[model samples]
Target: MATHFEHLHAVSASQAYKATFASHEHTPSSSIKVQCPIEVSFSDDTQTQLAYFLRLLKQASQQSRWVTFIGHEALVDKNLLQSAGIDLNKVLVVCNKKGHSVQELMIQALQSGNSSAVIVTGDILDFTSGAIRDAAILSESFAFVINRQAKQQMTIH
Candidate 1:
């Protein structure tokens, strides 16, 4: 099971890179920015989804760059992440409660050139597709947005 999960992670990482690079050919005069948006569908198995996300983060960090997560404080589990072999020191969590708009924080993180990938969840109305593309072009990192409300079903039956 673990091997299968690892294989899936590897495949996902490869696909992300391919999609990111395939979209842009000519090298920008400034820096390399890869736009990779990973969407997490809402499900009863939040832990499973979280584990998969952590795996993605670990893969991104393998490039020796930091991973910045901007979202609600309850969305990330430090203990679970540490258990997954991710270095807490390399992870930066910016809570949405800090009074800054989540979108603003995301933009700052992407443009700061300090993170390899920025994972954003919750309240992403400010992150328009054009804005994300522009940010990716201006920074040296990848951006992933988690759709926490995706696949929501009203009927319990």
Candidate 2:
């Protein structure tokens, strides 16, 4: 699968560290000092894109802090989440209502300093992504955005 993962961390990883998932090598979580937003663009299907999110959600759920997911209400499945080793009690799904954008809610959640991580799925404009990044930095937390692949040459619009 082709996965375009961006800005997952604020700094580069040590050369010695590695992870098994993709061609990308990741440092150990213990070694990571700065948290940031992760933007994922999958060149595969939605199923593959969701797998990337599932892996992240599972890791975030292990923390004692709250793990929040903004929007994607139609896709959240109890059985799937439970089966993925994600603790339901630690998870909170926020649906978009009351006329607020999903990314806006995500920024709020990240800056709140209450959750270990905030996740959402959609195309994120660079400015909004930067805001989310800054918010995550302030709160010392993680933010994630998962985007499905589009036909033709893809741009993060």
Candidate 2 residue lDDT tens string, 111-143: 787777686766545324578777876775656
Candidate 1 runs further than 4 Å off: 1-36, 45-51, 96-99, 123-126, 150-157
Candidate 1 lDDT over residue span 112-133, tens digit each: 7788778776533435455555
Q: What's model 1's lDDT at 7?
A: 21
Estimate TM-scores for all models.
0.59, 0.63
Could you tally the backbone clashes for each prediction? 0, 0
Clashing pairs in 2: none
